[model samples]
Target: MSSVSTRASFTAPALALVINAFVWGTSWWPFRQLEARGLHPLWATVLIYAVAVLVILALRPRALGQLLRTPVLWILVLASGTTNAAFNWAVTLGDVVRVVLLFYLMPLWAVLLARLVLREPLTHHAAARVLLALAGAAVVLWPAGRSGWEALPLPRTLPDWLGVLGGFCFALNNVMLRREAHRPEEARALAMFVGGMAVAGTLALVLVGNGMASPPPAPAPGWVAGVAAMALLFLAGNLALQYGAARLPANVTSVVMLTEILFASISALALGGGHLDGQLLGGGALILAAALLSTLSGADAH
Candidate 1:
């Protein structure tokens, strides 16, 4: 590529990454709206991701061939799928601020998963990053007025647990991306979108079968339109992620993705959908600081 072309490729991918973060940051609102229309978040997730998957397969039939030839892509499917299912469900059940902060703990998980899966050495910086994240999580999860190491802090609600678990899956998803970096881009994108459908659809079926969630009602034109729009946005964001992750360093992508926390926090608070008290602020700072650490070296190798 020419010098100007090279620069555009780099900058454009980074911008696309930021766009992905922004879309995810603001996505909770639509999930909540769909829930109000009797479409449980899980069901909505299934529908939205199903649509995205159909669109992808229709446009890139060759991507399916790429995926079937790549076994690792199946794991990618599971990781990315569970990440979406857990996060979408958790956001509907928990405060958006709390859920988002928990989810952004991805840096902590990324570092550890990298060390394990990629055999990256644990440096002092990475160790400190882990400690800071742990302390921050403790501070955030510790209930108000309950202080002084009274007990090991634990996630208190369904959303809280789901958020943390989803963060772990997200970290795994990213690690797999790095692991499979040499794969066809269409294949990688196909894995995530298809995973979104398979995982969420399976979970939705189980929940509805057990009466824990209602079967999706006849589509209200209003919510169906909203679901269609959000599905398109998610499809775009996934494409952006593939573009950005391919062009940028993995660590840089992780750090830029942290902007989702800021976007979610501000939007949730402004909309009266979430609270922002002292502990959350302090804890979120520490967690984000750990993520920021990775960007300093501009490398969190897979």
Candidate 2:
């Protein structure tokens, strides 16, 4: 009887993480669809997160006060906000697989950030993982039919840059979550939700003001429905993430979250939003290998 209860407790959190992964993995399709309907991804992020924020506030109004009073949570707000804004925009404008692969570089950034923020020692194993991940990134960024400095493995497109940026911020967000795990869960959730809305909303307004991007089209059933659905989905996913991440070791959380890559890859390929090739497969394998190693090492460390 005790064993059964223990297993249930363990399984529930792991499954919750999987739920979060699935929501994000398939989110690109909806973002793209909304974009087609004249809703920019930034604007869509604002609306989706706005709904989520309202729901959270309705249920736990004190979360807003907690987030505001806790100075450390402000870091979480910026990190989570930047992660969603950058990733959503990048995935919408870039090859889904490539963008995802780039974003999954989170592990590399995680290793570094954990060391810096958590004061985790930079062990030899961690260093090796970093090198492996860097090699994988180079392979992924390697250009075809180019040579010398011109072919340097660097981000050449806007989507590529955004992917890298999002990955870094996501790493920071995860580290901050672990750091502040003792905080009230609702406060953390509120911070993340608010970040998404604030960052995306500010960017959208800036772009619209400068005529760099079109404003959100007048409300229509198509985008309205999409935004509403996404709001609920993201809210659920965020809550699951908070619950699961808080309960599990960060390394274990990372391993489970890798399913996001598989989900994104399959969905994008099936829907024609992405393609596969030798270079990508090879590089992706290397990157994932490094990430797996990093997680295992982190678990062992703890």
Candidate 3:
């Protein structure tokens, strides 16, 4: 009976992981469409997340109450917010492969943050994986064959930095999530979704304040339709991710996150007018391998 129940418990999380993959895999299309229609990614991010937060509030009012009672939840909000904003903005403006590879650097950041924040002592194997990940990133970001040390090698574009920053923020988010694993899953889910809105709104305000874009338009009728659809998708994705991550071990969950890159890459290739480039594919493979190995290493050590 215990064996049967254990197996049964895994089903929901496995299904949730699949749904989360599909949502992220196909997300680039809607982002592009919204961008073409003159709603920039940042605008769409704020619109979608705000609506999702409202949905969460309506469905689980208690989640907000939980958040209010705990200061740690607010920290999660900040971490999650920065992560979502950085990812949304980076993917919109950069090469899908390049951005995704950079974002996978989360494992390196995760390991370091885990050591400091969670006090999970880093093993030598983990340290090696981090170095390999960094080397892989350097190879990709190194300007087309200008590998000399004096080149001050860096990602030569704004989107590259955003992608890396997003990954770092995601690492912080994951660390906080792990540290606060004792919290109710509902509260964590609320923090993830609401924190995303907070980040997007703050960034949008900064951009507008600095004259980065024109003022937003007054609400429109179709805007309602768009926001509704966007919110539903965002809420579904967030819930699926939370559900899946909660059921799986940390290493398994980390491995599952790799699906986003696959989904993003394949969708970008098929529908987002992206092409597979050798430098990107090579770099991406290394980064993904490092992330997988890091998790596997930890699991093996245990």
Among these predicted structures, which one has the highest TM-score?
2
Candidate 3 residues 1-302, lDDT tens each? 99899988887787788788778666767776666666777777878888877777898889989998989888889888887788777778877767878988887887788888877888887787788788779777767645467465477687789888988888888778767889987788789878888888878888889988645566665555666787797778777887887688767766676688888888888765356777777777778888889778752210
What C-alpha lDDT does candidate 2 achieve relative to the native structure?
0.90
Q: In model 3, which range of ten residues has the least summed lDDT? A: 293-302
For 1-302, candidate 1 gives per-residue lDDT tens digits of 59999899778988998899899998998899899988889888888988987887899889999999999899999999999999999988889999988887877898899988988888888888889889889888987666565556789789999999999999899889888889987898889988888999899999888989889889689889989999899888978887897788766786777788888888899887799999899998998887788777544543
Question: Candidate 3, which segments miss by more than 4 Å at Cα?
Answer: 1-12, 145-150, 220-223, 298-302
The TM-scores, one per candidate, come to 0.91, 0.94, 0.89
> Which has the greatest lDDT?
2
C-alpha displacement of 223 in model 1, angstroms?
Answer: 1.5
Model 2 TM-score? 0.94
lDDT score at residue 162, model 1, on the 0-100 scale: 92
Error of 2 at 268 (Å): 0.6
| Candidate RMSDs in order | 2.7, 2.0, 2.9
Alpha-carbon local distance difference test for all models: 0.86, 0.90, 0.77
What's the lDDT for candidate 1?
0.86
Q: Global CA lDDT of candidate 3, please?
A: 0.77
